[model samples]
Target: MIRHLVLFKLNDGVVRDDPRVVEGARIFASLGEKIPELRFWECGWNVSDRPIAYDFAINSAVEDAEALRAYVEHPEHQAGVALWREFATWVIADYEF
Candidate 1:
């Protein structure tokens, strides 16, 4: 399986409660049901307030690299990316275990 992880940090002045942020989270939360290639999905706000922590995170798994690619290229996923791009910056990692 391919493990895909992402960390998101809201842009300066963008708070978690902002409508756009909430909607972005909602969009991501819906992906597990919408994307068939996803074998696992978990996303949420970070509980820590530490300066080093990201504001949100995503942990997901796919059957393989091909499924991971399909998930990334999926239109719904693209829509979520477009929305989040407006208010946050993110980092990601993909690995196999």
Candidate 2:
């Protein structure tokens, strides 16, 4: 199995309640049901107030490299990414388990 993790930081001056941010969050939240390659999916806003904490996160898993590739290329996933591009910046890590 592969674990895919992502941490997102909202852009300066942008709040989570902004209409665009809200829509972006909704899009990503729905990806688990929309993408078949996603074996596991959990995403949400960060609850901590620490300076090092990112604004959002995505914790997911897939079968393997091929499955990961498919998840990355999936159209619904791409659309969510596009929406996020406008409001946040993120980092990702993937590893075999």
Instruction: Give the worst 10-residue stretch by lDDT in candidate 1.
Output: 44-53
Clashes of each: 0, 0
Candidate lDDT scores, in order, read 0.98, 0.95
lDDT of 1 by residue, 29-70 (tens): 999999999999999999998989999999999999999999
| Residue pairs in candidate 1 whose N, alpha carbon or C atoms collide under 3 angstroms | none
Give the per-residue lDDT digits (tens) of candidate 2, residues 1-97. 9999999999999999999999999999999999998999999999999999999999999999999999999999999899899989999999999
Please give the lDDT score at residue 81 for candidate 1. 100
Error of 1 at 23 (Å): 0.5
Output the lDDT of residue 67, model 1: 99
TM-score of each: 0.98, 0.98
